[model samples]
Target: MTEPEGSEPAQDLSDQDIFAVLDSDHRALLELADRAATTGGADELAVHCEQLVMLAVRHFVAEEQYLFPLMRQHLPDGDRSVHRLSDAHRHLESELRRLEDVERSPQAVGPILADVRARLVDHVESLSQAFASLRGEIDPAEAQRLGDDVLGVEQLAPTRPRLDHSDSPALNKLVSLVEGYVDRIRDAYTHRGVERDER
Candidate 1:
């Protein structure tokens, strides 16, 4: 994924704190949103949307599993903030599903895409504010430890949306593993086909 202009180079999550990792994901998502907004064709728009969905699912899963719980523990009003964020997540997920169908008719996707972008921008801003508050209350070491925990959660997170298993981390991880295998097989097939065509 491309880093946003003026952003720092992408680094391994192990090398950065939780804020940095989340910021990176937010920037990448914004970039995808911009691309989706400007895409000319249905195919191109659909590709951007798909990338957005995958990034969003993984990002949310990591946050829900690691970051938010920590926030709830550290921040005074974290419970309310986290609840609001969770509601936004559900709304965004629903929009993502609609986007999949809207992409099939490119003309119909513009408004929905705009809505998604707006919601994402708002969500990112809220998260940044919450993290800033969190950082003030915790030591750097604790923040770094939380970052490591987030990295671990991300490792097992699914790239695709798990609508039915939203509340079950185990199920989501299993589905993600299966999805990863399928994606690898599909990618290999496509690569081989391209190579044969070139030959």
Candidate 2:
């Protein structure tokens, strides 16, 4: 599949590593959060907020599909770690959905956005700690293979949060296939409108 427009070129998973992939996503999310927090206009805030949610959803799904399972196999106390991360994922997804609703309403969303930002920061810190704990637990080659698997999963991951379904990998993939197509169509439509407005 072709890389989405505006996405970085697909990296060789063996050479690139999962940490780099996840770090890139985390940076994009932090930047989006900053923009959302600072933007004065509701329309601009909404756009940044939407992008943040999409990226977060994709990142979490990729970890669930590939990273956590590998951790379960390699890390000590892996089950507890995966459970903690999964809980955080669910909470974040719920918050994103709430933010979406608030965005659509006439109500002010500054406080909600702030709360989301705080949660995201905490989540990233916890994830970093988990990764650090995994150092020397698995071979570098095995880690690279797992990272490659995650990259493949990410290519087909949903760009929208899916809070309604159970967290099964198989189910997530099926739902993502449908949601990813819809997201692409919506993005294309929005881009065309922007181009028309720019003319």
**What does the lDDT come to for candidate 2?**
0.70
Q: Which stretches of candidate 2 lie over 4 Å from their true place?
A: 1-14, 104-107, 165-167, 190-199
Q: Model 2, 1-199: lDDT tens per residue? A: 2222244674444465677667666766776777677766566566667667777887888888777876787777888888888888888888888877774422566777777788889878877866776656767777677667667766667766675644576776777778877876876667521223242
User: Candidate 1's residue-wise lDDT over 43-149, tens digit each?
Assistant: 55666676677677778877876677777888889889878888888888888878765644556877887898899999898988788887788779877887786
Off by over 4 Å in 1: 1-13, 164-199
Clash-forming residue pairs, model 2: none
Query: Cα lDDT of all candidates, in order?
Result: 0.71, 0.70
Query: Cα lDDT of model 1 overall?
Result: 0.71
